[model samples]
Target chain A: MPSSSSSSAPTPAAPSKMYADDVSVVVVLLDANPFFWSSAASPLPFSSFLSHVLPFLNSVLLMNQMNQLVVIATGRNYCDYIYDSSAPTNRKTGNGKMTALSCDLVAKLEEFVVKDEKLGKGESNGAVMSSLLSGSLSMALCFIQRIFRSGTFHPHPRILCLHGSPDGPEQYVAIMNAIFSAQRSMVPIDSCYIGALNSAFLQQASYITGGVYLKPQLMDGLLQYLTTVFATDLHSRAFLQLPKSVGVDFRASCFCHKKTIDMGYICSVCISIFCKHHKKCLTCGSVFGQAQSDAASETNKRKTIRT
Target chain B: MPEVRIVARNFMDMVASLPAMKLDQLYQNAFICQAIVRSLPPLAKKYVIQMLYVEEVVPGKLIEEWVLPDGSTKYRVAIDRLVQLRIFSETFDRTSGTSYRLNPTFRVNLQKHITIGGVLPREPMSATITVRLPSLEDLEVYAHEQWECFLLQLINSAQSERMTNISPAMMRIFQRGLLTQREKDAPRLTESGFQFLLMDTNAQLWYIIREYILNSEELDIDSADLIAFLLELSFHATGEAYNMNTLDEIQRITIKDLADLGLVKLQQGRKDSWFIPTKLATNLSVSLTDSSARKEGFIVVETNFRMYAYSTSKLHCEILRLFSRIEYQLPNLIVGAITKESLYSAFENGITAEQIVSFLQQNAHPRVAERIPSVPENVTDQIRLWEADLNRVEMTPAHFYDEFPSRDVFEAACDFARECGGLLWEDSKKMRLAVKTEVHMQMREHLRGQR
Candidate 1:
């Protein structure tokens, strides 16, 4: 019999290596900044954007029976988890209804957006606000860590950030910190930029964490871009030819002026970047002599020239 | 450290082996298509989704370019699997070296499934109609008990306390390959039955389900309809009660049979009756390679060959007794030891050393499961040695020929047997030779013709 023959083969004298199961837990960080979507320059409207995103989320869950999903809405000032497929409360409503996940996701997102809009009612005077991308990334990482600790089997966890808002230079340090943490945890951060300009923050995030960073040329095919490029799990990414990143913007924003610069004076004590020479570092309050500032600027100029 | 590997014939393999027409028919349902997509290899799934919206036939070289040079093997496997399942239809033309187009039905249905998901065929009955539905935990216990009772019935029909509920038809499915019955004696475990007992729960569950589906044809049921319904049933949320009025005649009967197997728990309320899917039913669509579906380990084996199983179930005790000697039993623990005599008897019953080692590893307590070798190395080695001892001697049937008039005839006969690839042994001095029973007739005819 097949069973007897298979069992007769000499068994390996070691624990079977654990294969990376096809299952994955995708934590989607969706940019929900109303200011970005409400602007006339935005390519995709909020409603149609959701129309594309809902199906993509459903596709991720449908890819594998054990695959999990978590959707966190990144608002201008705060971020909150909108939906989790593995949560017991979500499963209870999932019952025989196939669209339960989509329904729940949309309703919760609408509620969150309304509340966020109410808080920002006075600030909607044509001023663009950046979505809390850094906070959302940190939240996604924490959620992944919790899943890893709570279960014996670890599903391949990843973060997919779908944001169209422009980057806020003030949040550079926090975003970089989140990026490094994600890198350390081996979680890839996939970024899908739906805005006219490519997001420099997300480009670096994806590059550092070994994930796909795509800015689709046409926003009309957002769903196609999502399913084709961002739907792949980490395990399968090695085999598929994902869109290659052209280049990453590694320039750091200066703490003094919040301006991104290719070459800058960095405070040795706190590693804070500055566009111009400063006797006193604003960040760590460390003092520097004239000679030190002159020498640092000379080296910075040489480094920029060589590059 | 000896890994236990059960040759689980997963549902996908069965689906892949289906005839082309049947496969197309199976893919007609959106849920089945989704399940098929779920069961694909990771690369294959990516290919399907990437091609879900593309209407044109993609060149083979273009698909090949998607993988790195090192991933050629994976790429080949993915393409082969997709073609075998008919999810990707391969075409060849002189102009375009080779190309593949997604199966129209599969593409359309899967696109619909992803873009616009559909609800299950049946909806859950309202709380008022199906009052006091069992909790998820209770449903799990019910499913476990029912499955265990069914397996116990297989081991020994009289050993199961609740054998009365198992119909003769259901029992017949279990008897086909696992048991044999004599004219005047009760049914006995066959060689395969011993191996079946050593399989983990998920493998065993799949085995029975496969048998049930395979046997459905004899009962005048369309196997295709049964498969679709079963896969759809897996999509139902566990512990939720679905109204029975939604099912057709065949489904109604199938649901009853499934209840006996503990896939679903049948409940009756004041004026309505509904069935609640248990974890088992909900896990049906999950591929067998997914080890996460396995229950947590409960058996802890020490290096000294002593075992402590923290399970109170009688089924656990009975299964343990198959290859180990039971010392004593506590309310929540079963103490056992792996001994030579017990292992020898187990080997005699056709259970292999690997199965025993794997059974132990699979059931190792969560505390020790993290260890490299869940079961002690010495115990696994000794069990393997004992099994090797039984395999030391092998018996083969042969026909011995002697008393040949001349060495020439004997030499010719030897050459003839050798050429036929059935020569067992030969004695040059005595002009005697032994040929395999299968080739004896040919050898005898050749010798007679030479004379």
Candidate 2:
């Protein structure tokens, strides 16, 4: 089977590559920065991201017969599943009620939000990456688990994400767990961080998970990037030469300061990274005594505290 | 490293055992298969849907009337593919020409797939399916390393085994029919092997999985179970871990083969736990033609007959070596030339100029891809001309029919042969016409005792 991407010309069509019908579940994560999206001249507006990426999502929907699209908004306590308001097929469910088109999807997404809020919103300034990651991943896992039970498990359902923020340092471990979940599951994560100045966490998400991570330089050309970068299903990405970031920032976030750091002291017990010179591991509560050689020179140097 | 002929032979051998045949064949005698039920193009699939509830297969001639005369070609192609693949069949009658019939199992499954809106009816029903569960960890690992190992195995096979980057278990899978081994010596590519290398990432994975499924039956596993699992895996989302509790006994057993092929990640001693279907597993059924439009970087061919690929993956480089003579490789750049010698070498290995040209155009980088003709017209023409130099003669083995009682009979048979592109050579003299196709020979039998 020819696995070339373009079929317009006389190129060998890769017949066995992944098609839209091969998709089982499609998870779409939208960046809900309404303040930024609503601003008159926001650097990266939500509407722009939507207009740029939705067509690609629609293209994906158009490709598969059994394909499903689940859109989730990630900002504050604002997790909502958006409907594909245009789908004629969706209109038939629940006796022609469009809302019924998203019944199961909305219920699952709500389960995520309710469960996270119950866990008492953590200290991440209302940016719900943890909830997004946990809820989305677990729900996906649960859904897959159920399908497998019914003798209908799809091993590689695709996840198309549109986000514009770094994952919190506190949720780094959980996020990595989610990343490993994806990696181990053989799912390639395709992500587009539109108009974000700097996002180390998402870079790692795209890179670690073997998904396409594109930062659209030309904001207006968002659709092109989405269709080109995220549109190719997991199967075809192998043969067609894809553009990947050469220099990925592989740095980790410091647990102590909750800040991204170039270098940091890792706790010997838990491997929790920290930026401060500490006598004990804050995460695991392990204490360390100063060595004699270090103590002997301690009196020789004095440190000044900045106000 | 195997001889190109041997590699090609092995690939053909493997293709013979491809599990895809069962799906095709199940529909062969039958009208449709369930997994592919929802996948039929809306129009043709709609045709099938309309015919599903009916007791009779509409007469083949009626199909022409249903579709506009201008649209007959497409309708014919679809119906022919369905028949060729055995999804639909024509039943004969003494007085009438023929009527189409849907394959029984296919008709049932397709109706279910469509009527249920593609969400399979939850009822257990008569179709038998069993469940086995996998843990979260097992699912994750299965998905991660399968394709990586498969690609690594292909790359490493081209070089020395020791220098190869793939793992041992992965290598062992290659040694078995699960992954076809390129002999460690000859190092030239055969037609099928060349085609395999040139396939998109997803198709390549299926090429390997189909190979594995071909071998699975030999290990006493039910091919249907494997197929069902594969179809299920294709629907699973990426980055999600599935519980192992849902696996069937056969499916659980199949996980070992999948893991060996790097299609699934199986944690140690976690037979009952969940396993993830890697991108390779999930994309096993994706067609290869859509890769470029959805891909970021693409192949760019210059007018001077030079080629540049903007990729760093070793697998891509290995694929390039199938045709192009590589000059140098930078961090993310590969430079190659389309020389006459390389083209001749490719042809010598049984690859056609058409395959080579199409491969180049298919993988054309987006920069060069933007142009109407990805490759310069001169370069494309040269490649074809170079191929013509090698393949100077067109040869085929066929049965020749010449004797005919009358000009009317000879002319009728000749028209049929010409329509099928089977008429090789003919002489109007001596009441004889040379017909090349044996398929028409069968038709000749039908015309017997008529005139």
Q: Every model's Cα RMSD, please? A: 7.1, 21.7
lDDT of 1 by residue, A44-68 (tens): 7898998889888988888887888
True contacts kept of each: 0.55, 0.01
Q: What TM-score against the true chain A does chain A of each candidate get?
A: 0.86, 0.69
Worst 10 residues of 2 chain A by lDDT: A1-10
List each model's interface RMSD: 3.3, 12.4
Native-referenced DockQ of model 2:
0.02
Candidate 2's residue-wise lDDT over A1-307, tens digit each? Answer: 1111111221121234333423435677765544335444345565456544544554455344345666765644445555543344343222222123344344554565465455545654543333244355445445445544653224245566676654556655555566556655655566776544545556666676677777778877666566555654444443434566665665665676667666556555566666666778787788745664555524422121110
- lDDT (Cα, tens digit) per residue for candidate 2, span B1-451: 1122323322223322445556555443211153344344333443454465566767887765655465667677657655654557778887767788876666665444332323311111111223333444555455444454456565444432323334465445544532335657534445666666665555555556655666677778776656666766655544334555566677766666666666665443234344555655555434321221134445787888788888776667777776788899999998888888887777887778777777777777766766789888998899889988766787766666656878888777767677777777778787555555566666577358446
Name the candidate that leads on TM-score: 1
lDDT of 1 at B435: 86
Instruction: Give model 2's TM-score versus the native structure.
Output: 0.44
